[model samples]
Target: MTELEYTTFGKTGLKVSKLGLGGAPLAGDFGITDEQEVQRMIHAAIDGGINFIDTAPLYGNGESERRIGQAIVDRRDRVVLATKAARSDMRYDYETTIRSVEMSLHRLQTDWIDILQIHDVESQPYELVVSETIPALEKLRQDGKIRFLGVTTRNLELLRKYMATEMFDSIQFYTRYMLLDHTAKDETIPLAKELNMGVINGSVLGMGILADAPAPFLREDIQADGLARMEQLAFLRKPGPKGLIEPAMRFSLGNPDVHVTLTGVSTLAALQTNMSYCDGNGLASEEVEKVYALFQEQPLFD
Candidate 1:
């Protein structure tokens, strides 16, 4: 196998693998999971040079975090662990935020988190995030509970609010660099670059559409559109030295602003395939430009 690449997590001063393992699949979000198999996959990811793991309480109701904790108990220092705190109710107050962090810490079985992000900041009120949530996170940092603070959002306006506060060390957002959407590239990415914040690119596979998963397997809202887009992207998957996923992974990695690109896998084979793509050289600039040109005329989705 080729060597995996590593990069500095912007402003955090921690070196992270360019490809990080996402925790959703571990919780059986993709399908029914075998506990032992999940453990093996986590170990395989770490052994394969994945130094970062991201999870959240919303994923399978904390089962993901629990499995991760068990998988990395002895190897905690080897990976940078990150989890999110979801604002569960209308009461977006400091106590609620702190309680979420506390629960996350227990579930993760870690004394201190490498990164604790506010999950889906756009769902909560901006004033509450500014007045209560961020301050509570700051308090957690000061208390030696978390090393850094981050935020994840799909809302550009919410992202702007996060940037203005200058409290976030990183930002996680969905960017289908391989697909038609360029919202992240056109908006939040530049602002994050200016603030020197790390960028974690999620939904790199367009919720599995680029991977050619059947429409029945996709989310309800995107099934129709995703299937159509998959048809358009079928040419990239023709039997070749490099398949569609390779180019998709490479495209996201090619962006200088993207510090880490996340890929969620339910099986060992899927994990290995992603690792291979990370080890290989990214797509050539001209090839990337060609692909981009083909999708350039397509409508941008939210």
Candidate 2:
């Protein structure tokens, strides 16, 4: 077993594990999840030195937060709990924003969230996020409901737009920074580093594509592209228990620019496997250069 490494989260000065536990799988978004099993996995993750956990109301309609809250209520001090608002069952209005955070607090069983992010900001109107959504988060921060502000979006362009505002303490983007798509490293990641905002890289396994189980909701074109790319990178796969998963996990874990790489696992076994990759190992310098040369500026999704 390898010891987990910690990083200073951007300018926040919050010490976060290089690997964080993501909440979608626990919410049963990926498949059927057992409540007891999920709780146990949370405990194991914390015990294994994974301090940062990310979740959102969109994941199984708050089931993720509810379960996680119940699991960590007694050990909350050991984790940097993070959850999202505005993408739940309400509009992105001021009142709804406040209501959303309050609801998350209830589900999480915590008085205050370490990080409260504006979920999928690109899906909402920019003016709404700037005028109403942000103000609501600011109010929550002032009210001691959340300690820091962050934003999540798959749209790299929109992510940069929000990062430019300088209001957020962190930024999270998925899929774009994975093996099949290295587009984020081109600008989005550099911008976040330049602004000194914590960078959370989600979907490092390309939503299970790297694990040989692509998500059902992905487009046929994306699924095909990911599979093809996976085949091309077969040489990087070391003979091990996880095969491609090992390299996939290390790809993001090894990146100095990525502060936190989120691992979405439903079972204790999966959590343990991901935890094992946190041993300060990443792809070789030559392998990284080869991947960059292969993908270059080509993005997998439109």
What TM-score goes with each of the models?
0.91, 0.97
- List pairs with backbone clashes in candidate 1: none
Q: Per-residue CA lDDT of candidate 2, range 1-302, in tens?
A: 76998899998899999999999889889999999999899999998899999998889988998999999999999999899987835579999899989999999999999999999887788998899999999999998989999999898989898899899999999988777889999899999889999999999888888888888999998899888998889888778644788888888999998999999999999899889989898889898888888888888877
Residue 148 local lDDT, model 2: 95
Summed backbone clashes in each candidate are 0, 0
User: lDDT values of the candidates?
Assistant: 0.80, 0.90
Superposed Cα deviation of residue 298, candidate 1 (Å) = 6.2
Scored against the true structure, residue 94 in model 1 reaches a CA lDDT of 90
Off by over 4 Å in 2: 240-242
TM-score result, candidate 2 = 0.97
> Highest TM-score, which number?
2
Return the TM-score for candidate 1, rounded to 2 decimals.
0.91
Range of the 10 consecutive residues with the lowest summed lDDT in candidate 2: 234-243
Top candidate by lDDT: 2
